[model samples]
Target: MTTTYDPTHPRYDNEGDMRDELLRVYDLCHGCRLCFNLCPSFPSLFEAIDAHDGDVEALSVAEQDKVVDECYQCKLCYVKCPYVPPHEWELDFPRLMLRNTAVRRKHDGLRAKLTDQALGRTDLVGTLSTMVAPLANAVTQTPGSLPRRVMEKVTGIAAERMLPPYARQRFSTWFKKRVTPTLTRRQGSVTVFPTCLVEYQNP
Candidate 1:
């Protein structure tokens, strides 16, 4: 079959259809095992199936969710897969996990769905946090702080996780002020895309 991905496709509209597609991909991945060590998701999937005598159907919903959650969209499996695209066994592991996540978000309760939405807006969060960076940095860094504990409870982020501290001055400000190197020899023009980390947290 010629494989394609469309998030709005009718197949993904029904939870059962999505689950079936996930199970089909899981069975194929279990048989190949080429991406066993690439990411946590692959190993988790393989282990669950192996425990159930190589039967994907034997794995519980919770077990399947855990496997999907372990995949952080690294896409390494897709890059390494010999059976992607034009191949008869067209497996897009990262996209599959993403589709599963979409289904999860759609069915999640209000708080969880909001949390996921907030997490997705990294730029907005970065900008807002950087505005009061010192206070934000202190609260995030202090393991047992009351604010940290409260944030953990509300956001489901671990209180002890060492989050990157935001800079008082944004990267664009610093970059614009810095003196560029004057080249004596002819050189090609260079461009930089300061990612979110460089723009806010690190810079």
Candidate 2:
């Protein structure tokens, strides 16, 4: 009965469990349709469900993947949903999309693209890749290299695609260890709320 989006969950990588969770949430989405216009995934999901005469369980693996692939985690649907969390449905669209990618990476392995795996675990990948930044950078930046060629075959990402390099240290880590800049004049402090995209695009 649990619909966990946490990768740490025991069932997180189970294909059958993932499918059940998808059906549960997709059914909720189908019944409501409040956020259909929020993204391309919803319209495609609704269309497929309707084609099956409103039976969400009738959706094939390919059809389910169609919706999962369309979601880019903008999270507008989660904000717009009335059945989120405390409502007992525990509906979390963005996290569910994340779970789908994580499950695919673990279960599908070679078939699961590197871009999808890297995008989902920005923090983990950034930290680990930063430890070997030069080598990682070289492989990802140089498309025709032997490492990249092997990478493409193993992870299904094209050798020609350039992955952004990981920074030497996480921005937060750098900011904390940085020497405090003295202000010569009175200045107002501001906070930045950058999207997840900024995690990999560090300075």
Candidate 3:
């Protein structure tokens, strides 16, 4: 198995190679278990391996995907790992999982495909949602509501999870109207870049 995180690598998203790499890394992680305290992904992985009598290969694709699903790309494992780039083991669990996601999403259903596409267009979604901020905020105020539950089914984002609320007015709009015009004396000019993360969720 080629231990690689580079997407440009020829075998980066090759399913066959990815499977082999998963097994290799899973076996290493299973033995080290140093990241046991980090996140849900480690616990899930350990439990799955233990259930299969310490055989990493015994984990089915679905089981492996479950472990990946539990990972929220926190990358805490990379910091805790002793076998990252500088070491010969060259393990990068987070990047491997990202590759897994990229490859797997291609085979996802139409709803999931559409949802993924929509999500990638964060600027568009953020703009639209912020345009109707009052109604959007009200509808998504709480988790486990009918709307939230329906959203979970449609987008695969957990209904029990809540993102930071969108600002009634996006930062870009506010900056242009409030700050940009008021900047009579400018020591240094600044550029404000906005994405969904900032424009909606955490603005």
Could you estimate the TM-score for every candidate?
Answer: 0.79, 0.59, 0.67
TM-score for candidate 3 = 0.67
Better-scoring candidate (lDDT), 2 or 3? 3
The digit string of per-residue lDDT tens for model 1 on 134-187 reads: 988988878867887887777777778788888988898899999988889989
lDDT of 2 by residue, 46-80 (tens): 99999999999999999998899999789999899
Q: For model 2, what is the alpha-carbon lDDT of residue 91?
A: 91
Worst 10 residues of 1 by lDDT: 1-10
Q: How many residue pairs clash in each candidate?
A: 0, 0, 0
Clashing pairs in 3: none
lDDT of 3 by residue, 102-200 (tens): 878766897788778666787787888888888778767888889988888888767888766667787777766864356567687667777667777
Which segments of model 2 are wrong by more than 4 Å?
114-203
Scored by TM-score, the top model is 1
Ordered by lDDT, highest first, the candidates read: 3, 1, 2
Which residue runs of candidate 1 sit more than 4 Å off their true CA positions? 1-5, 72-91, 193-195
Clashing pairs in 2: none
Candidate 1 lDDT for residue 136: 82
lDDT of 3: 0.84
